[model samples]
Target: MTTRTSPATSGFGIEFLGLPGSGKSTLAGHFIASARQSGLALDTVRAAGRRAMRQRLRRSHARFRTLLTFAAGAAFLRSVYPVSKYEIGAYNRFCILHPELAHAALQAMSLHAADPARQDKAGKLWFKHCLRFQLIREEQGDANHVVAPEGFLQKALSLFGYGAEPTLGLETYLKLAPLPAALAVLRLDPTEAARRLTARPRQTPYPLSSMPPDQQFSTLARWAELQERVAADAASRGVTVIDVPSHRESSEGARILLEQIPEDALCSQGRDKRP
Candidate 1:
């Protein structure tokens, strides 16, 4: 394992997870800027699921999963998404010919659903994505801290993509991917989150865009609920999970979350001192 240390205080890893349009990315940006301004040494990593999955596939030699994930991303990009959105495509897509595939993906998103049967349809992308994220943190040298959005906590909670049943349950995911040092969840009302999604300038592919406005609202609402459940569960496991309600001002939310991270926690005990 690569030792991780932070120049700011002690080395620490922090992640932000939430529904689309819930301002997760925006909040992460604020946190990164603030941390850097405080002279904290860290890396801002985007939770690019397909890319992460691709990396994990390479290492595990999972040839079939690797091909499928790459193929899906290519097909979706070539046939579905618009050009303008490609520049800033934040969410990952799975290629499905039928609208029902999208709907089923949403259905499987229920927190209580049984393990999904169609892992190909939903699980492959999420599982690979999570695996890669774990590898990145584990391999990094201890001198630096990591800041990411939709990272390990989100993946463990099945937030990467909705599945009727998880291919790997939370317990299994935790076993495979160890918990991070700290987690800060950005909370937003489902309705407001939906509104932001609809109002965004770029076009997004399914499952958020697949549903009607009303149905999207419900799905995002469920997202908020599941996030809370995951955070509570993480807290029970002794992982530092802090809920930063970002429904109001995003800056204020970031400020509140910043307060929760201990100064010493940011530095990983000077595990690595190479300047």
Candidate 2:
């Protein structure tokens, strides 16, 4: 008699969900760097802004092609460029200023005027872009891990609007992806997170013609509310949310996270198979 064996499950994966200046990006950088240094093969998925001209050039054949193309290009550029860096910085500098408006602006850009099909295509493109980058690390024979910031989901939702509840697709992706055995939620106090952001070396120019102060304040309030909602939703799921106090040293935090990885999952002789 022949017996059937179940297929091996895919390795564990993780997603960091949080607002901008919430330390998701910074912690992701730290986590990835530590994993690599510890001889673990890791992959990273970064959500970056694509060049405006390239997007416009691709849609050149559409109806009202010339005018629509320019308008779209201008909007895309505005969403990311001179305005983006400044608007983001200003909002961060004074949380009270136009937070809701800023959040709305971000949401608008995320949901650009693309048909459903085109939007789906964009998501695939983003996934492919991340995969391509992962392949680069693969060539180096490093451990494989994928890291993307919280903004990734927010932006995707803004663009795609996955129905009333939202985040359904994000939840599905997490469940389906072959991630790590342990899911770690790197957390820092809000004050500390803000302080680290302020201390960052690079600074962008703030746009003067931005939304009014009251509008900005409303946006900030909304942003806080959104963060609470995301955290609550994520916790309701089975994700292992880890809070690493900012006062604690980075090395200590990294060590705590490293310890969370299952012992069996560690690459023995740097050749462990996927879980």
Candidate 3:
């Protein structure tokens, strides 16, 4: 883990977005490590899921029932928690002030239902849950740096049965989210991403059954779409989008993104107005 001052207070922070195998987390780890060594005030938070599960497991005894209960509690909290309780409270409040944003987000999300590439309704629902989770985290004032995997929207769409059509539309909706101080889209080839994922160090409470073949294919397909979307979106946004090509070394790819962090942006921005 790394520690730094909150960029929110300083009005600085960077968000890294990409697909699962596109190396967002890998790159984020390197960036956080380098930023900390350089003495920058920064904190990293991942969207709730495996990361949240790990956090819960660390605090409680690693019992299956406890984990299940925690998950259920978190989910319930996410939907019912007052908007003010979320980390993305400011953004959510903004949405309330501008209900149109929420409407647009939903519309963008719904457009995916007709997409041809989407086959997994479960995956789409999961993706929506993640989006909500992120919004809630932001509302709660718990997140500063958000590292999103590529094809994040695409994955969500596929999970919900929306295919490529909605997948493309979701890209537009992503831009509507409160803009990060800095946004970096990490790009990589699908083959290279798949290769690296296979070779990368596995971190977790694992079971071969955890990621069965059906799920694996679904995730992989989502990853492929994510790479494509991130590249295109980042280019349009004129954000610091780095393409870590397949031929490049992983360490080198990591270095490319790490180099983009502005020293001033590394500090943590302490608590701000909640939703």
Candidate 4:
């Protein structure tokens, strides 16, 4: 089928979103290879991983000072409740600057320490705050036509860790990043997703590894549901959203994802747009 083409603007960007073990990296690899082979004028840019973010913070005096403050708060949290350095760092990187989210993080930790039953609710609220901040950072970048595999959508899925509902965070992220040229959501069965996650080996014992299979299934399902809702909303706004099945071959999924992107989006018009 011939795909409709939109004018290749300098602002074209696409985000590949999915839960862990949902084939995001595999599909992104296939998509990037195909795009390059087809001579598409697009660059595959991986999301700034946590390590990079930490390195950036370590270098900045202003940010480092803020990190120190967060570290102190985290120390207190550790005294009261078990907390992961990774999560505390995420909160510091994303939520420290924002008052609302900072407060939410404290509240979430407090609840997690005092009321185990309400921990999930508090955590989800904190996740929503962090997700909003992360999405804003994504938009703050100067890159155009970015092939982001693990973008803000990952944060949306992560909200499930804090609570059962992921929609509020997902919705807020959309408001920040709005409609991209393409938003390809990788879909998979919750049970299948859990199986995949279980089989995978981790470098370290993280929270995800410790999560129960039932919780994993529920979280993945919620994430997929939110993706569908976001896709529908994007459609109303004229943004293209391609739903790729996790069961499909990565190559085939890449083709479908590419097809949804306008041909003009692949053309480097005049200037050198290399990043």
Please name the candidate that would achieve the greatest lDDT relative to the true structure: 4
Q: Which candidate ranks first by TM-score, i.e. highest?
A: 1
Cα misplacement distance, residue 13 of candidate 3 (Å):
2.7
The predicted structure with the larger lDDT, 1 or 4, is 4
lDDT score, candidate 4: 0.54
Candidate 4: 10-residue stretch with minimal lDDT: 1-10
lDDT of 3 by residue, 99-197 (tens): 543554455444544433322434344334444444434443433444443223333323322334545445444454333435556555545545555
Worst 10 residues of 3 by lDDT: 3-12
Worst 10 residues of 2 by lDDT: 1-10
**Could you tell me every candidate's TM-score relative to the true structure?**
0.59, 0.44, 0.50, 0.58
Model 4 alpha-carbon miss at residue 47, Å: 8.3
- Tens digits of per-residue lDDT for model 1, 1-275: 22332111222277777877666777878877776666665565433333443454455455556567766766776587543132222122221222332343344454423534433435555534433443343344332366666565665444433544444244434333335567788777788777777787375435566678887777676667677766775566555677776745767776776678644346632544212
- Runs of candidate 3 with Cα error greater than 4 angstroms are 1-12, 46-94, 108-164, 171-175, 192-230, 245-251, 270-275
Compared to the true structure, candidate 4 yields what TM-score?
0.58
Per-residue alpha-carbon lDDT of model 4 for 151-215, expressed as tens digits? Answer: 44443444333443333344444444323556788777777777777777582123456567776
Per-candidate clashes, comma-separated: 16, 21, 41, 0
Model 2 residue-pair collision total: 21
Error of 1 at 112 (Å): 14
